[model samples]
Target: MTNAKTLGQAFDVLLQPDKFRDYGPNGLQVEGDREVKLLVSGVTASRALIEAAIEAQADAIFVHHGLFWRGQDGRIVGWMRERLRLLLTHGIHLFAYHLPLDAHPELGNNAQLGRLLGWQADGRFGDQDLGFLGVSTQPWSRPQALADHVSAVLSRPVTCVGDMGQQVRRVAWCTGGAQGYFEAAIAQGVDAFITGEISEPQAHLARETGVAFLACGHHATERYGAPAVAARVAQDLGLQHRFIDIDNPA
Candidate 1:
């Protein structure tokens, strides 16, 4: 068992949440028990995940996406109220890290995804250096080959927006709804850009610039960071840890 504040402090030290200007609060969004023995980690703190945590008797829940965000309705009602009620009723602490989790060199989503796909990050690009510039360790000569590899690894159909014959060597990527960074990645002279989602303009841009684009599912790409960080923290703090993957098709 460990003090809840100590766990939070450990995460703050490792992730440095304050360094990123994120869309939502980055740490300890909901307070619960003062002590935590078991930690549950997941991609998002949706109702299903919370219920699973409850079932597992987790004292705290760590996630990449939290219950709250900027520009959202401040009032606690509807789905928000229910989520809050469950946490409060169970006395489960809620901790979330967004951009900080994404940007961490080793434990971040981009880094973990790169490691999973055998890509090497050589540099960073885009806003706050959230996007990664990398090269595939294996020579994926064609866009289709890279897309096929991504699909097989992520277990979800990848959406490719470029000619199959396009030669792909250098690559850039940012996980989770970062299609806006495509042009910035293009400027870096990468042959391909991979992200969790793609927008309409990206298709046109891929055609015009001949830069291949791949949209792996947002939830699929971000599944690693929270669990990886949580497991390390749990090991360091001598607390039990469980990662519950509530599958999300998005």
Candidate 2:
């Protein structure tokens, strides 16, 4: 069985939180079990997810989204209180890597998406709080082809707008809730953009922007980074690890 100190140390090295200035505390949000063996990895630290970690008997819950943002209320109440109560009651560790997971050069969400879609390594495009834009190696085949590739890889359903067969040479992607960047991608002359969630205005924005848009499920798209990070940590630290993906259809 792993102790809390060793687990925390391994996560610090694995996540490298100093590199990305995140909105919330990026590492060890709620400390519980030290020597972690079973790890529950997911997109967010919702109440249900916390319960899942408990049900799985996990020592650590690793996720992309964790509690305690920069400006949010620090009080424990409502949903926050319930989440904390669950963790504390179970002695389950909560570890989150926010911007660090998104911006990591290799293991990040953007990086993995680019690699899966065969995009070449290019630097970031822009920022909203903190984000990056990636480039495609070869020009896009068609919007539908790209969308099909994304849906297959992410294993989540998708919603697409704009011409399916439009020629796509450039792509702008921000993993979760990045519809606001529709205009940003347009300004950059990107032919297509992908994000986790979409709003009603986003459909019109895609039409106005004349860019192919894909709304891949937020949970589906972000699941890779946590498990990849987990595997890396296990390999490097020689610790037993498992990434539990609690399904969220959204």
Candidate 3:
């Protein structure tokens, strides 16, 4: 077993939460056991995930999305109470890393997705440098082909907005509901923009701007980073770890 305090300290050092301004508190959102023997990672700290982790006998749950958003009501009621009740009752530690998990160059959602898609990242842009700007290893002569590749890699159908045969080279991506950053991505002159979620205006923007757009499921795109980081931490601390994937269609 590893001490939760020590593991959290290591995470703070590794992730450096202080570097970014996030929507929610960055680390150790809900404290539980002092010692962690089995650690589980997931995309969000939902009731389903908490119950699954409890069933799996996980001492802690590591996640990309955590409770207590910036503008959310602070009361422990409704869905929040249900989630917290599970964690508290099971004495499971909840550790969340939002922007930090997305921004990490090597193990981040953007980086992992880039690696999976065979994109060569040259730089980062957008808010707190959360967006990745890259070039596809293989020139994409058709938007549909790129969409197919993304769908294959993510195992989820992708919605594309652009000419089917449009050629694309430079690409920009930011995982998890970062459609607002498309403007910044457009400013970068990327031929295509890939993000977790897309707003309605983006369809018009894609058509008018002649830049391709793909809404690749927020949960699907952001699933890799948290588990990778969790596994790394568990390995470092000599604790057993498993990634509990609570599939989200969003």
lDDT of each: 0.94, 0.78, 0.90
- Per-residue alpha-carbon lDDT of candidate 2 for residues 10-79, written as tens digits (9 for 90 to 100): 8787667887666788888898845677777777898888887788788888889898789998788998
The alpha-carbon lDDT assigned to residue 14 of candidate 1 equals: 95
Better of 1 and 3 by TM-score: 1
Global CA lDDT computed for model 3: 0.90
Tell me the TM-score of model 2.
0.86
State how far residue 147 of model 2 sits from its true place (Å). Answer: 1.9
How well does candidate 3 score on lDDT at residue 56?
95
Q: Which stretches of candidate 3 lie above 4 Å from their native place?
A: none
lDDT of 1 at 214: 95
lDDT of 3 at 136: 98
Q: List model 1 lDDT by residue over 120-205, tens digit each.
A: 99999999999999988997999989999999999999999877787888999999999999999999999999999988899999
TM-score of each: 0.98, 0.86, 0.97
Error of 2 at 149 (Å): 2.6
Clash count list over all predictions: 0, 6, 0
Q: Tally clashes: model 2.
A: 6
- Candidate number of the best TM-score: 1
